[model samples]
Target: MAEWTIGGVLDAIAGVIPDRLMTVCGQRRSTFADTADRSRRLANFLAGRGLGAHRERHTLANWECGQDRVALIMRNDLYPDAVIGCLKARTVPVNVNFHYTPREVNELLEYVKPSAVIYHRSLGAKFADVLPPDALWISVDDGGVLPELPSAVRLADALVEGAVDQRISPSPDDVVMMCTGGTTGRPKGVLWRQCDTYTVSMNGADHAYAAEIAEKVRHAGPPWFAVSPLMHAAGMWTAFAGVLGGQTVVLYDNRETFDPKAVWATVEREKVGLMTMVGDAYAGPLIDELQRNSYDLSSLFAVATGGAATNPRHQQALLEMLPGITLVNGYGSSETGNVGFGRSQRGDTRDTFELRDGALVLAADYSRFLHPGEQEIGWVARAGRIPLGYFDDPDATRSTFPEVDGKRVVISGDRGALAEDGTLRLFGRDSLVVNTGGEKVFVEEVEEVVRAHPGIADALVVGRPSERWGEEVVALIARAEVRAAVTHDVLHTHCAAHLAGFKVPKEFIVVEQVRRLGNGKADYRWAKSAVLREVTPA
Candidate 1:
């Protein structure tokens, strides 16, 4: 088989790798055997409920009929069995952001109108008002809350009794949808596939890294512990890469409420050899904790950072703190897999590019094949095994995967260029999306919320400098009244009504007037610089 369905992959792995220890969260250790057993039992439990293929096709259509896309609003449990279960039923998971507040959660439910939602019991209340009274809701009791929804099934019991059905296989064209695009609102789902997952591991850059790490894992314990949630692209790709290589993946269940101290303790206790992070938000806290405690971290083989740009200052500090440690700075995105080929030793070099068509070219920061006299910056494009299309959205699929002279190539929105020797230099995302920590917040979306405030006429939400969070959101509001003074506190409270926690501005800056082009277009460069000076101390 080119690639088995999500279920078949697990089943095959279980048969071949029965003795291996799979996932570790604190003291609870789940072996490959345990995971497979639980998954099978879970399948049986659902079968017992008359929810399997035994039901007539038309009757089954009553719930899933006309449903092209669905969301799996669930938390990370012992193993990601729900991801397998949903895929078995030919339903791609939306993987809704777990940090979404009740209001935001409700809005997404309205938008997707999923036939069914498999959520945690604690999250049941979050969906109470959002979901239709009769909409089918199955709360996976993660040993936390007792689910009393109309259609309730305690996961432990449900999994055991669900009947077994014909194993379904997913094709390469089938999607493993996660994050949303659209930049406007109600995020659109990004697509991936079983083949893509396997391909990411087998990809040139990733393959070399995995082989190097596997050798290290043979001599040492687990090579890495994923500090961030596996929901995001960086975290998910890194974690999955570890999984494909049979390296132990150590992750905390409570990444939603990040605790710097707990992370340190876990590192010390778990003997984490590699600590992978993407941006300055995680690096700042790690550096702070390293300073506070004189703990022995000799087991920590290296520190890898990617997903966002890291400042030279931050990179220098981290190297000084963890001398003799491998500090790798890499780059990639959800649409285009792992494009950044060069790895930074001290993390000083923010320059990134990928080997495309067997040559390293500019990713998004510089122009491709620069002319002798033409020195202007070029928008980056990676020419390689980028995805064919996005899930369900043909327009976006076309925008990213463009046709040049009838040849299709994926051009992610980020800008960059190639050097003479083909070393790729990547600029940060040029799409006007603010990556606060690891989460993406589109400026256009945030500006709409700021404009909703009665105190504002027009607004620009630009990323401001921050030592803690990689990028702090700053709203530069255009005021209508000459005497009105809009304070940061007032705007924060205003956002509590309409925006999610992550999207809300940490600090609000009042401007005499919002700078824009003659046609009311946002001048991002002007807004970015102005907000930086306004928020950052001199």
Candidate 2:
């Protein structure tokens, strides 16, 4: 069988379905032939500049990389091109959060130590002070009026100057670095071999050879729309899944903010069959728009959400609006790729996933794997085709991906227990657990009950330092409207019936908006700070 590297898969698919549409972003659309050609040109350009793999994976430590790193700091439009090109050249493409502050950007860049940086020209001024002196800079046009970097090469010029006919070879061991959002702490790069990534994230497990996969894609599938930023793992995985399946990948166009109307219009115009989003942060707005306006959404067959806790109420509302559509709730993270998934049934409020192959719940003591009907809450983990380790952080890599019974597994930090029937009963992240008055409480349990309230639009639960108790749970809520009939007593009564007394929040602070990361994961750091500011006396 051919090696399952992303570059090899791309070559096979392009060879078979070169005329099919590969990507669509607003007025921009590219065919497999065009995208493959452009990617080859970019690969040649970077290779000519002496950037490629310097050593194989076996020659380096788990926390070390010998490939030239290229930081991608642009939006979703040309992201596939950049990644494919880097892979073809045997270089690692690092994802950069474009919404990060200058300091955060500097910290990430310092850690990754990329040999090249590609960013949108509109962001040139943001990196002027902190950009490394030795790295090559390339800028893409975002149709914005901003000063260009003096040392950066325009992406257009580089593509034209690049040679198109050079032979390229990419190894399966080439690394792909995915950086965590760093909401709780500093961002860590999770490195995965390209072949393993393809197996775990790109449906490589279903086929034995790249030629067979390409032949299966003789007819184009319906377009898959990515409603989240590609810098994050959820969005990137979903988009690449479409590409590997020979489906048209549609990117959300509005970069500054998510415009629900614009998203639906694009879906309608493109006849998108599948749309992926990040839980309720994106679902709530889209639901509100659907209630206010009418659009032809007959083409949309499935709506998949992951990367955060999805509210079941929102899922029900979406199902009611679009009958006969499947609502898929996926479970996975950067460390564990595509662990499991569950579909939302009509009138069901619980989100439970069936563990995929190689996924199991580890015992609380980390000594062995748990069996079906295990009563103790354990850590959710995946054993095969997982990431290598956190880049340059051996301590974290060892802790997160420990060996149990001589077998390596990636612990996803999510606390869950196996049911008698062998399905996973997922709880909130164990890292975010709160201990108040000697009782451990999962914040997600409280937040789930709070969001079930009719008046609550969104909410986040966090722990704050307390005098009587070691730490107290506090809730930050965003109401559906300013005048919504949501009061402390009403929420307290609602939560009291569904949760243990200790799990209930001590106070609920109403906020205009609940802050979230660009990819819609809960910003626990922001929530903790907000709670501190609200409770502390000036």
Candidate 3:
């Protein structure tokens, strides 16, 4: 396989296939030629503002000082060009979650110390006061009531210049940082070399397979839609895969919030073939929308989910709605890209994912890889084509990316077991594992059972402080129907049928909604806080 940089591969593909449609968002569409030409001009635009890799900087109080960073805080619609332009200019593109509060935005910018920012006009207010005074700002129009940012350059004005390709040569080792927040408090940037990320997560094809993938896209590729926010690693990677394969990429144009009906309408209009979403956060609403109205969904052949766990009930519901459609659950993270894929059948919708090459189960001590049929639950890990480490976080990098048996591997925080059939049974993150009365219970397992209840819309389980037991399992449930219908006794009975007695929720906190992160991940921190504040007796 010939090593390929992100910009190099994109340019090579664009040069060969210039007339192909590259992206579609609402009323706007860009072909490969337009994307290439516009991105090149944008890169030149950024470079003209003195944003490039070679720009030296004074060492900050504690942060590393090198390579100019360009923060991206926009939605999925205009994300590709901003990212591609940054890469073409050899500038690091840092992901900024737009859902973050102003304080978080300020904190993240202080930590990242980016010299430039590309943000949506709708989100300009969030960073107007917090953005670095010297940062070069460019705002993309979102056709909304936008805040005034006097110092920022309008995207249209920037793109008015003549098309000129950036001649900057980017090394395969150029850094592409993905900012992610987990159960841990502060967000950390996971750093990956462009080459490693390309091969690992970006649907990289080797010399032997590149032509085949390109040809397939050229001949029979369907329009691809990433329903997840582009700020998320999975969302960006999924959309980028479309560009790599020379397929038209589609994004939801609605900026206010996720509207399932709007997504369905876009699919019908665009004839989207492949749609990617982040688990039940998206699937649950989509299911409700399907039940409410009839949609012409024959064009959608596959729906792939990742970045969060997809409950079996939702999978079953989707399968019932769209018979003969493929439902795929991609299990991996920013650190370990596309490690495995779980396919759901009509009746079998278990969370058992088939392991991809380089993925394995690690023993409890993290000393050796567990062989197939290992009874003990262990950490899911991936070797080969993994990220270098968390950016500027040596301690975290050392802990997450450890060398075992003379081979470096990424220890994804997920806990699971390896079946005798060589499939992995994921049991949520290790951090969320609960121990009550000396019995260990996986939160995801119990949550899955709770969500299966007909009246329950969504659920999150966390450990609460208890006098009798060290920590008791507590469930925070979202009631979709009558709250009385989803009684504690009823949910307990339902859970008891699928889970062990100890795994059942000892306490239930009913709510109208369950909160999720920008990437559709369960906000464990929020759950824990809510349980302690509301459920715990003073």
On lDDT, the leading prediction is 2
| Better-scoring candidate (TM-score), 1 or 2 | 1
Q: lDDT by residue for model 2 over 196-281, one digit each (tens)?
A: 88878876643576668767688876799998778888888889989988899998874577789998998899999999987666
Point out the higher-scoring one by lDDT: 1 or 2. 2
Regions of candidate 1 where Cα sits further than 4 Å from its true position: 4-6, 41-70, 132-136, 142-147, 201-223, 346-350, 353-376, 535-538
Q: Which ten residues in a row have the lowest lDDT in candidate 2?
A: 433-442
The sequence of per-residue lDDT tens digits that candidate 3 reaches over residues 38-148 is 778888887777777773322321123257889998987778888888877778899987766566678789888898998989889866888888888888998878665
State the displacement of the C-alpha of residue 488, model 1, in Å, after optimal TM-score superposition.
Answer: 1.6
lDDT of each: 0.62, 0.83, 0.78
- lDDT of predicted model 3: 0.78
RMSD of each: 5.3, 10.3, 10.4
Ranking by TM-score: 1, 2, 3
- The TM-score measured for candidate 3 stands at 0.79
